[model samples]
Target: MSLTAPARLGIQLQPQHATYGQIRDAVLRMEDLGVDVVFNWDHFFPLSGDRDGLHFEAWTMLGAWAEQTERVEFGTLVNCNSYRNADLQADMARTLDHISAKGGDTGRFIFGTGSGWFERDYDEYGYEFGTVGSRLDDLAEALPRVKARWAKLNPGPTREIPIMIGGQGEQKTLRLVAEHADIWHSFVRPDAIAHKLDVLARWGERVGRDVSEITVSNELSRGRLDDDHADALYDAGVRLFTLGISGPDYDDAPVQHWLAWRDRRNDAVGVDAA
Candidate 1:
C-alpha cells in the first residue's frame, strides 16, 4: 500500500426513509460542498430504522443522478450482482457513464458492485437466497461477462468505466478485486486495513496482477474520524474515505466536517483535494 493518491471524501446518501426529492437535494448539496464522489446503496428495504420504510431502487436513481449532477462522480456504494443480469448491468453502467459525461472528457460513474447479501431482499423479490459461497461464485462468473458486454456495446463507455468492488472477504472477494477492480472498498476499521491489504496483495500475486493501482477505500465513522484514525488509514494507504448518510432530512453537517478534514489531509500530503 502506498500513499500516492489524493485524499477524497465520498457520501453514500442512503435512499431509504426519504422521498426522492430529499435524496436529490442532498446529492446537489454534497456536490456543492465539494465532496469528491456521491453514492447510494442498492437495497429494497431500509437498512436501518424501519425495515419497511420508504426506499428507492439504486440504478434508476443513479440514472437521474447522472443527468442531474455535473461535477461529482456518483454510483452505488455496492450494487447487488444478483439483482440484474450481468450483461444488463454492464449496459446500464455504460449508458449511465455516457449520460454523466455530458460531452465532457470523462464520465462520472463508478461501477461499485458486490456479491449480493441481505436475504430479505432476495426472498421478497423472488430471487434465490443462496449460500454466501454460491453468491460469490455467481459474482466470479459474472464480472468477465460484464467486461465482454462493455466491449460489445454500440457506443462504448465514455472512458474506461472505473470498477469498484466492495467487501472484506479475503478469499473470493479479494481475489475478484485483484482480477477486476480499479477501486477496492471495505468497512474494516483503520487498524484492520493492513491485514486486508496484505491479503489483497497476496491475491494479486497469485493472479499475477499488480493491485497497487487499485485505490483503497474505507468508511468514515463520525465518532472516529479524528486525526489519529485518519492518519492511521492514510499511513496504511487509504485515499478515499466515505461516509454513509441516511435520509428523511439528509443532513449535510457531518459531510461538511469530513470535507474539511479531507482538504486538510490532502494539503498535508501535498495532493490537491480538488
Candidate 2:
C-alpha cells in the first residue's frame, strides 16, 4: 500500500438543477479554493433530484473547463466507455489535453473512465444497455484502442493523460485496473478497501505489473469530512479524496471543510499539495 502517497482533494460538480453559468462559476470557485482536481460525471441525465432536470453533457463541458481553469486537472468522474468509439474518445481526450496546456505547461487532464452501468442513460441515449460483464468486455476492448490512437495522433497529448478507472468489482474491474489504470477509484468503504486492494494485487501479479504506485481514490459522498470517514480512507491508502456537490446553489461550506482537512492531512505528511 502506498500510505506515504500525498493526499489530494477533488470535487464532482454535478451538472444538474443549474445552468451552465452556475456550473462555470462553481468550477472557478473550486479552483480558487485550491482543490487539486475537478470532476463531472458523463450522463445525459441527472443521477439525482428530479429525473427530468436541466443537465449538461460531460465531455463538451470538459472542453470548456479545459480552457476555463489553468491549474486544476479536470475530467469526467468516470467516462462511459460504451457511448463513443474508443479511438474517438482518445482523440477528444488528447484535444482537451492540448487545450488545457497553457503557458508551456503540460495539460491538466485526467482520463477517468469506466464501463457504462446506467440503464436509463443507455436507454435514452440509444446505446446498448448490455449486461455488466458484456459492458466490462467492451471497456477491456476499447482501452487498448484508445491507447493506440493516442500514440498515432498528429500532435500527441501534452502529457500521457492519467487514466483513472472507477469500479470495485473484484474480478474484471480489478483486472482492468491492474492492466491499464494509473489511478484506481472506487466508492468502496474504508473497511472494504484492503480487501479490494488485495484482489487488485493478485490481478497485478497476474498482469506482471506492480500496482502499488497506482493512486487509490475514494469518494466522500457518503460521509462528511468532519467525520472519521475521511481519515479512515487515508489510513486505507487512499491518496485522492473527492466529494460530489450539486447545483442551484453549489455550496462552498463542504468544499471549505474538505480543503481544511486536505491541508491538515498533507501538512501532517509534509506533502506540498497543489
Candidate 3:
C-alpha cells in the first residue's frame, strides 16, 4: 500500500498466428534483452485478430520456456482454472519450477492464475460454460487444493512458487488475491489503481493477512509506454509493467523500450534490477 517496489518489465508473448519455432525464438530474444519476466496467456484459441487464428496452448509452451530460458521468470499471464484439475496444476507448476532452476537455486516460475473467462475457450474445448459466479466459485475452491497438493508433492517445490492472481474484482477476486497471491495483476486504468488497492487492503484486514508485500501489475498500453501513466501507477504501488506482443513476427522494439524505461525507473528509485 506504500507504493514501493523495484521496477520490473514483463512481456506476454501471445501464442497466436505463429509457429512454435518463432515463439521459442521470441522467448530467447526477450531474455537476452533483459526483460524481467516473460509470460504467455492460457487460452485454447486466439484472443485477438482472427478468432480462428493459429494459436498454441499456454502450459505446453511454458514447459518449453522452462528448459529454454535461464534468467527470466516465466508463466501464464493468467491460467484459466477451469481447464485443468487443481492438484495437477500444482504439480505442473512445481515440475516447471524445478526445470527452470539452475546452479542449485530454485527456478523462476510464477504460478499466475485466474478464474476462467473467455467463453469460446470453454465452449470449444468441451469444458462447461459456467456462469461467472460458478467459475469464480470453482477458482476459490481450487486454490486451497492447489496449495495442499504443492505441500504433498514427492520432492516438493524447489522453492515456494510465487502465486500471482490476475483480476480486479473488488469482491471475490481481490479477496482471493489477499488470501493467496504474492503478486496481483490487472489491466485497470491508472486512476483506478488506488481504489482497487484500497479494496485489496480491506480484504487483507478481513482475511488477517499482510498484503503489503503483494506486487502490483498492469499491462503496457497499445501505444508506447507513457511516462505520465507509468509514473502515476508507480506512485500508486505498481512494480511490474507487462507488454502484450503477438506473432508471426514477435516484435522486440516495444519490449526493449520498456526494459530501458524499467532500468531508468529502477535507477531513479534506487531499486536494484533483478
TM-score of each: 0.97, 0.98, 0.97
> Per-residue lDDT for 4-45 in model 2, tens only?
778899999999999999999999999999999999999999
Clashing pairs in 2: none
lDDT values for all models: 0.90, 0.92, 0.90
For residues 95-128, could you state the per-residue lDDT of candidate 3 as single tens digits? 9999999889888999999997899888888999
lDDT of 1 by residue, 124-156 (tens): 999998999999999999999999999999999
**How many backbone clashes does every candidate have?**
0, 0, 0
Tell me the spans in candidate 1 whose CA falls farther than 4 Å from its real position.
Answer: 222-225
TM-score of 1: 0.97
Candidate 2 is scored at a TM of: 0.98
How well does model 1 score by local distance difference test?
0.90
